[model samples]
Target chain A: MNTHAPVFESVAKEDVAWLGTDPIPATAYYDPAYFELEREAVFRRGWIQMGHVCELPEPGSFIRRELEVLKASILILRSQDEEIRAFHNVCTHRGTQLVEEAAGKQSRFTCPYHSWTFGDDGSLLSAPDFEQFNVAKEDCGLSKVHVEVVAGLIFVHLGTPESGMRESMGPLADRMDELPIARATTISEYVYEIDANWKLTYDNFQENYHLRFIHPSTAGQGCGGDNPFGYPEEYGFQGPHRTQTIWTNPETGIPSAVQGVSYMKIGEALAKRDLMIPGAEKNYFALFPSFFLFGNPGTHFSHVVYPISANKSRGVIRLYWVGDDENASERYAREYGMAMTRDIHVEDRSVIERGQRGLESGALKHIHLQTNEALLRHFFNEVDGRVQAYKAELEAQGAL
Target chain B: MSVLPEGYEALEPFVATYAVDNAGRRAEMRGEAPSEVRDAFYAAAQPLLAPALDYLDTKQFADYDSGDKQLMWMMLSLAHVAIAVEIQQEDEERHAHLRSFMPVTRAPADF
Candidate 1:
């Protein structure tokens, strides 16, 4: 392959003419007030991805998720009517906590608190001494949360969203729907509690610029060869969300050992269908706030960050595959992908923690993003814009 | 699955057992929805509430006493109710949103 022409031009700030060249303030990452504002403005109002629909493949299947930052314990399940629903995992009676298990299959949730049993549809099925209740059974049903499925991914809105999930996702809705996410089953989930601002963790995933420097041995070798990892093949916005398409260097050849144990070939052969992203080995889609969808050769996964507080955050990297792992090569390939992803993340943890400590030390006032980090700039712009709008709304109501 | 530390498995179920994840700082409850009001709401739904309380009280659970067990349980319980209230509040808001979109010429369909 002739390496004469650049496959893609690196993204520059000037390319995004509306986003100025100003550096993002350090306070955006470390300040408590800003964190609170983000909680109220961005997280509460945004259409956030919760999990994949494949997680509960059958009716009566349920899973519990705790969003500590949003202060929510969500019970997501498929009801008897074969509809997916989400509800608060609290027993309405006596305000006792309900559904102790994290994930299970059950038609009814009996609040161990007072034995208030509710159907998978969130309807109150039975309660002790029911006739004496002041609140009617209809009113006593589990409180429902806003949940919608796009591209086989489940998204929940914490507050009354200004628009529907599809509208909120904007142009990415089509791309999301095209993804093989619904057909993929979760294979592994890794959780890391990093001592860094949630945004700091977020900033790490939006670009491949760090692959060469931060992941020289693992990702750098796998993605590129002698030449530096080039900029993404595409960089643009789908509403507030951003997408980056990456191609493996044509000249980059895997080692003989890699070829021998390669799982990609196996996965491709066994998969019923592949993701629709054309000519790209990988695609990075960053949804507003903290959800990131990464499409790989024969698999896909999501990196979701939930801020626990200003300085602490939780990171979940869930891996999914379309075909059976029954094939040895598929298993090997999936394992290879997991090992590589984990290594890259492990490298990131140290750097991001250091970033937070440095920002907190007050040594630097603003952090400069490079030309390739156009997505970071876009993210900060959206966050700042939303924060400003939230402030204005509060001021109008005289609540600020 | 890898076996956890001696009491780690036992304590895993208790993690965020309460609805610690909140939508916003006052959550589903609007301004000044008094604690007494919430208590009264609970009192009226005792049939649904008592079993959950009994489970928490009587269940043979691991002792994280050496590792802040009491504090963990308290947060989980409070978080549970905190989030529950948010759910109740948000459902009403969702119904209202749907109503605004559809024509109200006819009676609502029974669930």
Candidate 2:
């Protein structure tokens, strides 16, 4: 469904004065119109993370992803030539979804409905009764989508392919190289469905202030208490992406109550063995719009936020380990890690669901933002500015 | 085969079978954990086997290898016991001085 075309209007210099501090309309969370506008202005226009490169380890490996909101299907495949490629997951003959499964290794994708086949490189391989149609083989090939990799993480943008992925990722890509993400192996995956605005889920992750209250069991044991850990002043922001490095007083021995259980044991083990990595402390980075990368000194973890609906979001949290080993000890640890993550996710889901119900109460006109929530405020402000600009541009062209 | 723990009757056969399979696999892989320590972990976790088995039945645990879920849970339980034993061992090495400095209190119930 074509909802609305994004419009960009030039803003007066004076109008930009309240850019970051202005309160956005709450309707942005609940409005169907706004969601449609976002489909074009945000999802179509920006680089959205798809999957990791490791997922396509061998040639002919492919994964199918559904962009339900955009009404689009994507097929990410590793070609026979050993290059990763993404194509519209549709058959040219009758517009049928080519790949039905989530992931597998296949040299060619044959549509179940029409028996049309496509090669690993997304070339139209064959069609039954070719004399009937005037379609060329090249023209009948699956439509291509812009795909690029940053440190083994793959991203695809569906809009105009003019803006390169590197250009869109900007400085964030360089900053990500500081961590050894390429060497990391997936240890566990915790998936959860939360009832809340997608932005609210991001709001919860961007700030650690709610850790003590929302995640009392884990976060309180790990971070909260007498000497609360705070975000570093040297916080870096590139485009909509932001990161905050954490520092703990060495004398304290333990940083926060949240750090008491897991971190205390991990830190003690590292310190005693002199195995600590240099220049590493707790670091959290939020890739604008939807992803979070959190490093716990050694273990690297990521959360991919998928917006399913106005009031529902799916969070896929995956923890990565340092080495690639299928040993019993490592496997055992991975299972426990997954269980712990599942418990933590259940905690977050309950809170976000309650928050959504509260938001519907309309008891408060605006949510307060603390210094710790500056990133959340910044994100909303950025979205608001884009939406306003698009609205104004449409009005000016008499297209609204 | 004296009296088994409360839930051990339902789990003992599975645990015994798993122990044999695990030991065989560990031997094949050149793996070993202290026998005394391993026995202690198995004793403590034998009662919780019922719940762990139930959890496994639901696919609650991460699939690390193609094996029975009970065996996987036992391996994980053993790892936790191993880590705890290692920490206690380290404390002993430090002249038991570390324990006196930071007395172990019961962690918060929620935690």
Candidate 3:
């Protein structure tokens, strides 16, 4: 039997025209003022995916995350009752940072400046000369922040949340629960710090229009047949979040000998665990603000962009695996998958940095977007809507 | 004593350059290596990837001694080199600089 069918048809411009064809303001990508508004309006109150539940496995396990965007440090851990929680990594004694180590297992944290001890549940266990201070021990617990785990991904909110991340995600939350990440027991990570705006850096990945040019050699297999650029077959939006069904050319015939073996090894590993369900990798999730999760079962990964400032951001890409490497081939497959993906990501940096430099020069008032770049357009629209609403709220209060 | 297993003696020359156990150091070696060095290793090991994996599959991981560990580490290094030679090709010189920003902080093999 012979079958010839088109894998994808171009998503028409008119289908997404309601998002508007007007050029998006370039200033939003690099402007200091707009960045300030986003910090307050969007990031401050919204849920940011910064860590995974696997990082905090036991009661004493804790990891310190530096939230530069909020100028705050967070200590996420599992308490004695086996509950996961997040707290301001600040000691209530005198505002000194409590935990300094990046990650470790510790039940008691004693402030080095003064040996004020705190328990794993953020309770003030002891302070020297207790009667001398007017504060009660109950009032001295470390400041608490909202932390929730959905699909084994840890998200934290710095300010008051009108709705939690899982609630906000709605149906996408149930969909995410079925993916590989929900069952991940371990992870491999690669991190990059780039001198580009967070949106510009994230937008680089949201669209595949530049794949053939920017990643000519590494991305050859993904681009061919009807979709020369390997564009997504379909795009679905839910509130501020979105998902895309990635398309792949089944017969590009470019997998190197070692690369082919590595993928086959990974495929077998997934198949043994019954993770190779057909269309299991149907689509990937891009949570609001700056987070992305690929749907590929063999290489289940999430990329999050952390904003350090207007023109500087750090991106951490983590590949979640269900268990440890069982044998030589499994280990080799993980290495090849990681190294190949890293090379593809490396190709995107210089071009995105160049894009940021061009935008900063203040030459272009706005930037153009084609039909295929609808995801970027949607992200910009959602972000600007929030920022503009926050500005209006401030003006109403006479605080702007 | 040989640096690799009995059947994989041909890969002994790469033991010193690619047998580093840490993922960070292995990736650094790939970046710092010159074109001739990377190309020669790729040409040498390209044919052995399948056989090497097949050979290692014959033994349990815990039973491996020093020679087997070295060969295993070398094959891991081949993963990085294969991408450089077969994919990046002539663009490696510029690609190396781009990789400096991204570092492998954690992997399953690291533990």
DockQ of each: 0.01, 0.06, 0.82
User: Docking category for candidate 1?
Assistant: incorrect
- In candidate 2, stretches whose alpha carbon ends up further than 4 angstroms from where it belongs are A1-19, A185-187, A222-234, A247-281, B1-43, B46-72, B77-111
Q: Ten-residue segment with the worst summed lDDT in candidate 3 chain A?
A: A273-282
In candidate 3, position A47 carries an lDDT of 94
Whole-model lDDT, model 2: 0.59
TM-score of 2: 0.73
Tell me the docking grade of candidate 2: incorrect
Using lDDT as the measure, which candidate wins? Answer: 3
Q: How well is candidate 2 docked (DockQ)?
A: 0.06
lDDT of 1 by residue, A258-360 (tens): 3332343434533534444464246677888789877664446678998899999988877666644433233334544543454456566767888899999
Candidate 2's iRMSD: 15.9
Give candidate 2's error at residue A346 in angstroms.
Answer: 2.7
Q: Tell me, what's the RMSD of every candidate? A: 18.9, 13.3, 1.4
- Whole-model Cα lDDT per candidate? 0.64, 0.59, 0.88
For all predicted structures, in order, the TM-scores are: 0.74, 0.73, 0.97
